[model samples]
Target: MSEQLIQLRQELAENPYVTFDSDGNGVSRVLDVEWDFHALNQNKKIIFFGRIAEKYRLDIQSYLYALMQWQKKNSSSGSHAPVNSLIGSKSQLNILATRWGKSEFSLLSSEREWKKCTQTLHGVGNKGTCKNLASVINAMLKAGLVSRYVYKRDYIQWAQPDAGNGQAIAFPEAIHVSILKTVVEFVETYHPYRHQISAAMEKLYTYQDEMFNAKLKELGVSALSHMQMNSLRNRMSRITSQWPERKAIPNFSFHRSGVWLGTLLRMCFICVGLFSAARKEELLSMNKESYDDSLAAVPKVSGVSTKGNKGERICMTWNTAPIAKLALELAFDATQAARRYSLKRLANGYQNGLLTKDKYDAKRQDLESAFVSSDIPYDSEALINKTSLKFHIYRADDGFNMKEFNINATTEDVEEFDLLNPERAGSLKVGGGLPKLSPHDLRRSFVVFMVKNRLGNILTVKYQLKHRNINMSNWYANYSELARTSQLLMDTQLMSEFNEAIETSAVDAWDEIYNVSDTLSGAEGERIAQNKAERLAQGEEIVMSRSELLALVRSGDKSIVLLPTGGYCTNRNCERLCSLMDIVEAPCEHKVITDKAGKRLSRERDNLIASFRAINDMGDYANELILDARKKKIVSIEPTLVKHSIPFDSFNDDIKAIWS
Candidate 1:
């Protein structure tokens, strides 16, 4: 082997694709060419295959590069990007390698070579995979693994893909409200009789094996016999009859009972997803011990953030609504038998030496996951199938009686619902197939709802969604498309609320300017004060009320365009494309300097005076023009400070000494 290959091997050995949880427990490892994110609950393996001429070629450079990237992601501090993203970039490189008929790293010298290899590859026409491909190549170049002759600018100029799937589309407001209402009603109606429902499910679980065998024994049989079904129904009915609120129990059949339990479990998932804005993997990562209601007022749900945390099982907690607490509790109760079965099976597997210590520990950690899918023979595993959850969310309409749920809808909600769904609105039916919903839709909708209702902004949504930055939160909270189609925009009440919120924001800005100083400077500031004084002299109110200020804003008689330099630009139509930070040089007539702006001016004046003193001390005679300009700038700043009653140290004596 070459010396470089040997060195690469050593580096790969030192930095294997392995990661640990927050507590330093081993979570995942890459075995040879396959990475098993076992503890991460990722069922799939990210496999690396490098075959050429019908022989397995161990491309040590590519292998080491992939390992290093994975290490960078799953670092001790925290992950910067997800493992899947790494897998995706690697997969793109793999595709390029396959097409080029050689290792991709060896071919990265020029743009022509990259284009020649990637021209025929799928998705190369778009910037999505192409950008990712370029990123991988750039990383390789920067790491010195590739030729230094390659131009970084060649690949760095790829424009962002215009047609890529951006943030998930938020659900329509009517559908969003209806889904929440249905789930809430389900929780309210059934949460009281949870113990009885658990008992019934437990009884049904015991007979599941017998029922399965009976159906299997009879050829062409799709379901249990009528007599057998009735027997099971009667058994569960006996448990339901003891409920104090008997109305809580829906009309029960053996099959309907199972459907009800399944619906309840799925509803719990929906409730937590909608309220907490957690990702699907995070929600599925939840266990029976996830919900902490110790502080009843501030309940929290603990889950793993799989996106940015590499495959490390770091526990992240989200403060959730009270309804999430009830939903989690119900999900725990409903999955009790499944949890018991998984634990029993895990114990047996370990005792029989079928599972190693590492495997046993990993399985044990996931034993109590809140969502579980078990078979008739009692074999159970964590629920990770996203399609099953989507189907359940689509079928959620069947879980509740629409008539009962709609009774809680307000007149505005009803009108909005009717406008959105005219076909089934008056009948209170959901026959016209429900809109496709997903876990991500719930998260995006949560952001939109919070921002649109004026309950929060991108920062608050960032906290709720656990986004790494405000950019991502802003993407999720983008509701411009939804607003165009929403009935709320047409409703007078909603328009009024929107207007009030805008007016309140404007009023707060005005209050900051007016209340910051007794007197204001700048031409517009002087004009505004004169106008108010004239009104006061005419027997009008001396102090403007919030309502009057709002009217002024509404009438477009005054406007507040805040500048970055602690001032307001009151010019409604000055039409100068001016840089906000260039206020010192290009001062506009519409600028109004408040006390805050005066303080800023004071700092500028102090700095200029200090510069003049430094020039005088340095005996820099050639900088005489510079000294004169600084002095003039200071002279201009002092008047604003004096007018606003802001304190400043006078540098007139120093200026006189310098000139003399």
Candidate 2:
């Protein structure tokens, strides 16, 4: 490790809070250092040996540097690049400076001094500061940048392995199925109507364009193409992919308002997200034109937003509700309406409020693009259905705002709102005072439902969950509580079956009871398992006599009845292996038949006669042989039918008819 990091580690190990938790008897558990765990200084975070630096993919050096910068100047690393994002970059420089005196990322002099200084970063309530301190210092060591190793052994002892799903940070919850259902209901109840731009809005955009064009004409300013507008907007918006370069567009004041459209589209996104499990970024990236409306039963949605393209139709009869599809339809309409509304608003602005004939003729060239024609009037029907409208559920001002919908509230000044629209926010507030649920949680829950509902086989569930490999599918299956419970239940049931077999017949039973004790909440499964084990241990022959077995067979306790002969082969096309009797030939009384056996015997007799008649048509000689064969077949069926008390009058009549 680098010299700086080695010294930093020495400093961290000396901190009082870095010690492990212990009990009077022994070590109880690792105390604190949890991902969410905090310390005393409200502005700084506590770093410990057990912290997993790589969990958040943080660069330790940058984070430590940022923390030092913040401690010294109350400012971040001043990289003004993505590196500034390591930690504490979003906070006020002055506020950070107020918390800790100026500091530098340098080697420490002594253990006592290091420990005293580290107290500032240790056990701090402000996780951001703690993380910054932890990560940056850790990164220096991780990169082998530490030089001085005065306390290397102590440092090694302090850096313990992480305890569990270590650094347990807050992730979005799996939006409960019940809450999701209510949210859907809310959408349906208060969905906004499609946006409709008034005539005055058209005049506003048109006039604004004219005022700009007139000044440009006086100065000979060339007309800007639509593509150029997009380029200018993008260029002026962000010069760098960092906090420092953020700038607002110079020319733009207000584009247009589509608040209703935003609200409606949010519902659409939610519905699609629940069904398809689209991440916020993926859902927003979807184009209105991308929806595939074809295919029977479940219409397919291609590109349903994944790191890879697994977006085939997962709309199985079980996993999805019909409302999600309806929501998609609504989303499409909302998208179209928003576009129509914005374009018209801009066009109207260019034309001004006044509807004059002279303005249309004079500004014919510039108006030709968005307008219907130079001389033609604005057609509301055509305007809405215009082939060129592009509305991409982006943000409230333009498209959909996923950030707003997902967040509980934006700021204090603005009114907090949701479909639930709870007042004074106590309970029943959507995404508020509740576990935060992300799109991935919805996905995990979806897999759980697949196992719980038994909606699909393993392969089918895998396909629906859109897993790339069977290993991942198996991993998810392991995640299912229902699946785990089912395994326990099946094991218990098998033990019951085995115990019964051992009692009625002689066989060694399987033991292995204690192995599954953890899964068996109720002792019944364990008891059953124990019974079999005890019998096996006793070495007692558990077989019953033939009479007992016969009696047991007649007891109607089992599903498939057993007989001395082969099974009641209800298959009419059988080879007659059971007691050497086939359905076409005869019935075997010893057959372990179904209740439908009586009907089979009756069919056997008629089939015999039919064959006899067909052979008789050939000649008398052939008929004689066929008659003999048929007689034996009829005789075999008559005995079984009579034994079972299945009326044989029909068979008796058929025999007479063939002879007569």
Candidate 3:
């Protein structure tokens, strides 16, 4: 083993969490094999075990490398290392360690072995996993633990793209509208008596323990039997039957009341998630002080984004609609008993000297978290799990009859929903069950709705989604069904935007031909220039407003299609299927070449001339036809370049020497 590898192994033996900084200061991360990423709000841990811990031990080096890289990244920019990335790295490394056995980095040098190992991972079907594994291997290679030649040859040459897992489908428009309407109606119905319902729930919570103890004492037993517990629940329900908020609460057993209230809380969570486009962690980390509507016009929700803030919890604020304010209020009221129970426990723990000051402070911060599990005898520290949250969301969805709300899905809506969900396609009908919902689906649907309606672009939506880059924002908004359907059903505002885009293109073309360029090319360009000259002779300015150009385009007197070759094609009825390669060769009379097109032509001419010279320099007789075709292409671009006063080299004696 190399000296660096021996040192890394020794460090791992001493401390599992050791990481070195620029000043050689050792910083420890997690002290256990099962890392708890509490800041990430994940329910699971990144566990290293079995082969990763025993025979192979590749995880030691890979983990050390990941920590160093994370520290380097954090030092350069204040971006947090995502727990998901670490989990993915651990998973991929475990697979590699299992496949290669004790050979480890020795087997990685062989291209055949690398292919064999990577093929086994193809079934994993995650491009991010492949990237994670590659990052660790590359880091090892840079640290001189693996051969650098293998890094350049084998690792870079392999390609394993994800076939997609189909977890990112956006909710259809009909379902989205129905969910919002259902949540809004439910919140409005119960919001008026929120205080009374909270008080009643608190009363039920307080009486449950007292009644249970009293029943145990009366039965002369320490614990109640199954039948005894059921009888006590009935007695407690009868006792609260006369409460003023009985009508507001759902009709359920007193012990199962948390199920109904939890559903209400999840509905409010959905409302905030949908309107604000916040991630699941950001939404779950919200506290009582998260929402503010003092400005009335622009209400905002505050939370910490742990994704890219360099391991520091940076507070981010999202502007939301007024309905989000109602959702926040409803969520606060729904978790009232749970919050009270948590505070009471914290107070008792601190007073009895059971908890240190730091632990008490940490638990106190959790007390203010807006969402929690609503089980009776509530878990003060446990957040709601995905399964229970989805179950309640589904229950709320199934209970809200779409027909009563007059929500009828159109044929297009059903077709769009099917396109998004191919496996369950044709299962959604006009009045059938709604598709399964997830928090991510709401986020994707939000992006699709905003982009499809032209409310914002991908970059603007990135801020709302809390994405680190525009690429992820693009992925969330990649609803192909919406894009395909939008063309067939363009609304008036969309059509106007389309027309405005065309007018803007035409105005830019005309502006270049009249104001910027001293001369122009093509038949249409010459005619427009002569017309502008005559107008100037008659003491009239040639400037035109976008509205006037839009009128012309709408009236069918003018048309413009911006070409990829940096010019405009004005012949609306022309039948030439021209491409970038053959654009200069096309004999279309309506082509208009402005200064921008002239510059583009000049660059193309230079590139063609360089290719011609390089091929001729090879001194091969077989290149005659290729050289002739490229020479003609270069010749074809010169007229437009010369007409617009763009300078270029003519084929003279100096250039002809290459053809010798």
Candidate 4:
């Protein structure tokens, strides 16, 4: 993907609805949509003071002015008036500091006041929070807003560095690919008809119009009643029955099983996060109408992404992965429904509920302006709440009743609560039972599976993850390198068995690996058998750790490679060596045989020898077909029998000279 597309995809991953709360300062605040909007705003303050404050007053008017008000509210909202009222007034700043008890910009005449200011900070909060307070204080100093005049170095305890660098927590933890796949499957099945439903809606409006035109041309009739239209549609359906036809009915697993709507919604949330590899904020907060089916009728999710930019498209799924595209469509579908519901609910509360006309109209006007101002094709009554998902509160009692005054519930309390504390009706059995998964783990699972399905192609994973840098994505994928190596070894074992069945003409011999055949081995090889072979081979150990195991596998030494599976080496060349990092990890066709591998061949050779001899004794005059089949089977098993150690000289000159 191009850089522009990657950036767009990442931005599209943002949650669309901006939930707002007025912090008693006559300005609304947006929360939970950005990971660290507080710190992000703080950084912006630094730049605006140093370079942009005076130079770009227009830009600062909306952003910087609002930020100061927010900071003031955090410090002294209960007792004080608005923050801007005391901006350049030193007397008001001091009075504000007294009411606040501890302030970042508290006036400090002597050295003692600054020390006391920091002392009171740590007393009220832990080191972690104190660190944040110290940071804001420092910003005030740089912005030339601080009245404190003291040595900055003396505030050592309060201004100490964070506990650790954020590197440890940089990359997200991914769930198993199996669990993720199951979640995706559930989401797809749960809302399988979303696209069909949308298409049916569009078709409903246009099909009648088209039908009238067709009938007018063919039969000289221009109009049809609703009954006639229905009849004609049914007839068209029957006539096209012999040809290929698309059914509008849902044909997914959930429809058959009939899962609850809440469970379906929860799965849809997870599937979107897991498949998109988007940050938690991106998944939880989505545009009320994020799905666009304009691109060849495939739904593409679009939204405002909040990773280090304003109003940039965060992330989106392309035509590349069908499963991902479907997951996003369902999540967006839920969002569309939720937003419409919010609008109707809000308007009803304003019109019927006990509220002043002015208060009701304030919210009504806010929503109305959104529809009028934006390019989003919302009807004049779409309430895009700060949250895409909403949970209704209940009064504690013997009976359930939704809490009252919910119409005025702020964004802080009106969260997408289903993901946080989802009600469980069914068990996932991923591990023990599935834990209530966080949104971030879904993103991690997305990155991890992208790496796995591509077999450790880091670049492909990075692009899919939409990582700003490769390091974080690489850390997430490579964290379980040992696990990937273990899979490689398993692949080798499987391929070995596959080759064994092919060479010996016993097609079901390798069926033991899958335990599918009647004659398949249950516990094929005992630990004692492995131990005995190891003792005979001079106690050579299996490579264990990731680094050592990877080195041994790639060493290109005859001793380095283990005979985990039976060898099928002939026409082997030393020039070709396998890399541990390569996507193809199965046994090479031109494999080289070693002493340890010979042990497996010897055991197989004895089994074949016994079977051939027994068949020969019973088949002298049984039938021509049986005798010919047994002979051909013996011939197929003979070459591998020679590759293993045998009495070559004692055999006839024909066998001895066959090596040439």
Candidate 5:
């Protein structure tokens, strides 16, 4: 075996507790190993920094103070008794007098001058902070100005440098403390703080410092070289902020085919989010209760059905359910359409169960946007399945078949599949493969649309959008700006004459469009005046009341509704009918009928009763069919599709197609 491989084998043998797998790639080398002896041995002293820090449940700041006290008590000469050989006075504290210290190091300034400088620095009084003290002491030691020695096993004392060009020397206890401080600070700042941290413990910083120093020693680096050790710790602590977000809905455009597929998956997730609007963590942590599929329609979103929140967690999730439903259904439909059209597109689908995952202890996966391109997992071949028997057969329409679709699982299954074990969910089976979009953005888009449409109150918006902070849901404000401005404009007018002018101006513009003269001659003006008088005598069409219009709307004689009320039907093709009477009296068979109270009645019921009377004259057979169908499982006759065709002349051929 090669030297590197041999060294690795030795390392494995020495540290049998450590595990590594080489697979068929052959033996791998162990690059480095570090151990902390001081951290391991500190308990034999009067107090251990790690133990005190952990036991008291103190933060790093307070732990530093506790460590200083422990050091002071244990450093006295009489207290230097070693209970176990594991720890002796190998580490000790020393205070040197300025005059002797200066003479020993051949200082330009006396020790008194240095002490003055030290006193003025931060963390000089009481137990000085480790970082600050360590920095000062390290500078002094590097300058060859101070020295120290342990006179007894327990306590440290000062000493003069040996009189030679190559002088042997000792370091001050304060210098060691200073080094320890730097080490602790570095560890505390590490990106993922080393798991050793315990808020309950005292002297956390001190313990980390000792551990770091010991680690350096184990690596054959001079732990006594505080400057080098500090630099190394800093390097180890550094980390880059490359991963901007844990979950990313991928950034594919809505126009892309992948986007359609992605959007569908994302839409499903968004519906879940908006419907649940659970806290971010909770949303990610969701289980089965987050959705209800009891009806054929979209599931109702309710937080009462969610988990992870404290207290009753009872809050009504009120948002525009219709738009939410539309966006999701559209996304799903678009995806199904894309996959059905192409085999290559099928290959681009997301992994099955991508959104379904277990919540606990599992790593959160990336949330792709409504679209993403294909890429293999860089670290493993586990995701590849080309050789599997299931992979060779194409299933472009697996999830799209509603007749064969099954919605058997409950909230529990969703939770298990979606939140808990995301990795497992990521591996789910989909006929065409996973769609591009993920679930969370579906919720975000809902919030975006709600705000866009001005569909709900701020509280309702926040709940439906599932934002914890009201401020986070400001995206919708821009969409409602135009409507709000119009409302404000309508509520205020400078003068009644201005309103009349506005009305008059509209008619004048219409008159101008019909080629009516802007300036007519005397005879022409006289003719116009005569026509106006004649029209006034004849009287104009009657204006309907709000109740009358509402009745018409309810009756579905929506077509032929008046010009102004024409906007109500979202379907673009319906005729604009202003009144029920206009529809009923027209040649068209469709009629809007009203009761004596002027409320609308169902056309089906009215027609059914009429049919019954006509049928009684023929026989009891028809009545029996209706009765038996309702009362028992009788063989029912097939119902025919109703067609209502009107003559071409009856329609206002001049009117534009409503859909256009």
Candidate 6:
């Protein structure tokens, strides 16, 4: 071994491959190399070059090919980079043992013997397999028996790890040789490496899983169960579905129109995504100002705008230019409308008002906004202190407000104009506000259009979607394709249902009737007056107005207030309740134990006192009232009685029949 090393060192001194002044060093490469030969000598490093040294008898080309094969088979680093496994000489030697057809490399003899029957033929007993194998191969290679074939693991080729199909057999060299050849060829030719992509995604997912597992374990849980995985499954499903479709570029301008705001917004978002692909925060924070100066110089726009900071080589397809043009126009229109509204307000002098400009109005009034109100041409100088003159008009004319105008429009004038042309607003139904659509829908529609058009590079498409990775971008490509193929739009069934529910739940009418009861002189009114008088005599007051009284009587303030005993309000100190009438206006199931004067139960007694026991059988509305589930006592109560006065017997009886 010493003689071989001496000869090898002498040969290395003049060998062109070993002596070249690589990396701009004046010294020969052999002397300049930072390779850990000394570390190898001290049994601290594995010299991987040793494996194929004497395995084949051939010329340098054959040696190179064989070395490449060996590297391909053994290398774990995905790209052409070596990873430090820190395997010492012993492990390399153990690997060499297996390569040379050794049965096992045992570090612990007693344990090795104990598990001999269970061990496989080529399995190393955790002894110094890695280091020993590397050292042996490297030594032979140094003696000129083999050439080093430097290669990285073709992770794309070996997408899935071979776990050897459970049925054990001797490791086959032929299979590895064939695989190595294919891996090398595949790497040389760029192709869609589905397996490799899947592997990378899996590794990332595994890392995320590990982090979550650590968190769960720290919270005193063992391995996660199916329930926990299921909880996250919905998000995972979305991610999985999204992954394959991210990289498809669609024709963003194909569906350009006056009505598809959702489509337009989607295109703008995608353009923003493309420009600011790497900065998620910046992309999200982008506003009209982002496009000001950089794009304003172009002949298409009138004002300066700025966009998020993007790299210089932000590639845009020809199709993108039109979409960007439209986006800028919309942004300019919004900015202009806002500016007009602000100017009108200033023209009228300061007055308490709530308008669209208020949300982003922070700067000094001197700095006039480039974008002004939509009515800049006709009513630029006019001012209104409320939502808008148009919104008022809509309320008066149509009897309902359009909600979309609230989110996107500057004033009532804008709302009225939009509603007047329902066909222009994508044939949206006229009654409700803005047709239940959102700006995000436009983003989706734009991507779909882009996919339909096939207007950008695959990579460009992915970046345009603002995907964090190529995999995500690829997934978006798939989604774009699906959207184009399907031609679907936003589903609005739920929105319609929601509007219906809001209108039907009209408890406010009861409040109105009670409001006028204060001036009543009829027989029923006299009865109410008498009730108020009796309540006042007992220290209770009928302080609530007629409208308030009716609301309390007919409707349950389900969210804010509760009726404890069928009709009496439980919170006695609640100012909303009229303590004068003891009529409380509202009904509740709770009450305080009172004295002869009908004053509240004492403070000490109050602490001990509680309303009649109530049990909600199911859902939000209380159906059954039980004193105690174990006792099965019949609780009794009157709907209008105070909560505390209701007996458990009556309380249970009234609720039992309804519940059962």
Assess each prediction's global lDDT (C-alpha) against the native: 0.61, 0.39, 0.64, 0.38, 0.30, 0.32
Better of 2 and 4 by TM-score: 4
RMSD (Å) of each candidate, 1 decimal:
10.4, 23.2, 12.3, 22.7, 30.6, 33.3
lDDT of 4 by residue, 544-643 (tens): 3344433432353312222233532223253434322111344344443333344454565466556655665553454444444444434443454454
* Model 3 lDDT tens row, 1-660: 666667666665655543323344443343444443333333222334433555544455445444555445546563334556555556666666765553356456568876676665544535444555677667556655665343333343343443444555666776677777887887777666566666766777787767877777898987777887888888777877766567656552344447666666777778888888887767776755688888667789988766665445678998777777777777776667766765676677678776545445545555565665566443322322112221123343544233334456677678777776665567568766555556777788888877876878888788888777888888787764466466446567877887677777776665666677767677778888787788778887654555676677668888777776556788887667554345346556787778788888788778878888888787677777677767777777778877877777786412333334
Show how many residue pairs clash in every candidate, following the order shown: 0, 44, 4, 18, 46, 110
Using TM-score as the yardstick, the better of models 4 and 6 is 4
TM per candidate comes to 0.58, 0.35, 0.62, 0.37, 0.21, 0.19
**Candidate 6 weakest ten by summed lDDT:** 251-260
Can you write out model 5's per-residue Cα lDDT over 1-660, one digit (the tens) per residue? 334224433544543321122222212121122111211112121222232223222222121222322333556541212222111111111122221122122121345655543343322222222232343234334323333211221111121122112111111112212322332332223212111111101122233345666676677864336676566445433421122211122322222213223323333333344444443333322222333456536456433322212211343443233333433333323232222222222233323432112210011111111112212221122222211101111123442222222233343333322332232343223322222212333344344334434655567766665557777565433233443444345555645556556445433332331233222112223344456556546884323334454454345443222123111112226453533323334322222111210111123323434454455445455365543222221111001001111111111111111122
Clashing pairs in 3: 78-310, 79-310, 80-310, 80-311
Q: How would you encode candidate 2's per-residue C-alpha lDDT over 252-369 as one tens digit per residue?
A: 1222233434445555666666665544544444443335545556654443332332221122222345565556555554344233444454456446643223222222212221
How much does candidate 3 score in TM-score?
A: 0.62
Total clashes for model 6: 110
Q: Mark the regions of model 1 whose C-alpha exceeds 4 Å error after superposition.
A: 1-90, 93-113, 122-126, 139-162, 210-262, 287-289, 292-298, 376-436, 480-660
What are the per-residue Cα lDDT tens digits for candidate 1 across 1-660? 334445665765755445554355754443344444434344232334334222223453345355465446556764424556656655756655766666635445656776675555544434445556666666665545555342445433443334344345464466677789889887777776667665655666666655555554764555556787677557656864564434445643333224555666677788889889998778877765787879667788888775665554577898788788788777776566656655676677778776545456665655456665532232223222111211123344453333323334445555544443333345333443233356786787787777767777788888878888889888886653356457566778989999888778888767765544567777788877787677767987445767787889999987877765456788777665434324345567787877777887778678768778877677655766677667766776777788878777766734333433
The best candidate in terms of TM-score: 3
- TM-score, prediction 6: 0.19
lDDT of 3 at 369: 58
TM-score of 2: 0.35
Stretches > 4 Å off in candidate 5: 1-264, 270-289, 293-299, 302-454, 466-483, 486-660
Model 5 C-alpha RMSD to native: 30.6
Better of 1 and 3 by TM-score: 3
Task: Please provide, for model 6 over 1-660, each residue's C-alpha lDDT reduced to its tens digit, 9 standing for 90 to 100.
Answer: 244334544554553232112233332232222222221111111123333333221122122223333444455641111212222332343433343343222211234442342233234322233233434345335434433321222112212223221211110122212322332332222122323322433333444455556657776875557787556545544554444422322211111111222322233443443323322223323344444334433322122111221211132221233233334344333233234434455544433343223211321121232212222111223333221221111112322122222333334323332333222333232332333332232233334345545755566656554444777445433444443333322235766675445433433322321332332222233344466566667875444554554354345442122222112233435554333223323322233221211112222122222322234333323533332321221111122123223222232222233433
TM-score-based ranking, best first?
A: 3, 1, 4, 2, 5, 6
